[model samples]
Target: MSSENQELRKVGLKVTLPRVKILNLLDQSDERHMSAEDVYKALLEAGEEVGLATVYRVLTQFEQAGLVERHNFDGGHSVFELDSGEHHDHMVCTETGQVFEFHNDEIESLQKKVADELGFELTGHNLVLYGKPKVN
Candidate 1:
């Protein structure tokens, strides 16, 4: 087992084939954000026998353990992504619900200034920009 798997096991979660498979899939996906149905479909496409409920259960556990982060975008559905351990913000495609991650030093400085003016410490924040793609 890999170090990540060992850490998960140490957290009291059983080492199982399904959990490992799901974790690997999330670890390798490009988009990083996947819904329960997305994971279930991937498992079926990969010929895995895990059920949708199991996928959801494991994702919930991962979220509670800080191994994953879940987001509810403008679309009603939820999406889960691996925790990158870096602080950044999100930009969501309003038309398609696609997400992009970005960080800006200017924005961070402005946020600090605003917080200082308000006499508050800027611990953390979530900035999600929702908009349609520009036409060519």
Candidate 2:
């Protein structure tokens, strides 16, 4: 079995052609985040015969396997991204629907301080900032 197939087996997912295609597409994405529709379009553009439903199914499996993360942000449909094993937050552009990831030490320190004062130990958090660009 190929390494990719082995990974699917390890995650308790049955290895299939459509699943492999979706996994490869997710692996090759520039931003590593895509909606099901976007992934379907990508597969069509690449001449892969995978359907939209297959893309969604494969993404769901990948999410369950800890190979990907799904987020529903700002009333938009859910987005899927490969798990990169790093901690960060997202900033969304309201005007253009773009996303940027960033991290700051000062913000992290402040969060810890606030949690400490509240008598709670912080285990995890998600912070997303949304705004439109300033008109010049």
Clashing pairs in 1: none
TM-score for all predictions? 0.91, 0.89
lDDT of 1 by residue, 57-131 (tens): 999998998888898888788899988889888999888888899999999999999999999999988898998
Q: Pick the candidate with the highest lDDT.
A: 1
Off by over 4 Å in 2: 1-3
lDDT of each: 0.88, 0.85
User: Which candidate should be chosen as best, given TM-score against the real structure?
Assistant: 1
lDDT of 2 by residue, 7-55 (tens): 7888898888998888778887886668899899988999889877778
Q: Candidate 1, 8: how far from true, in Å?
A: 1.2
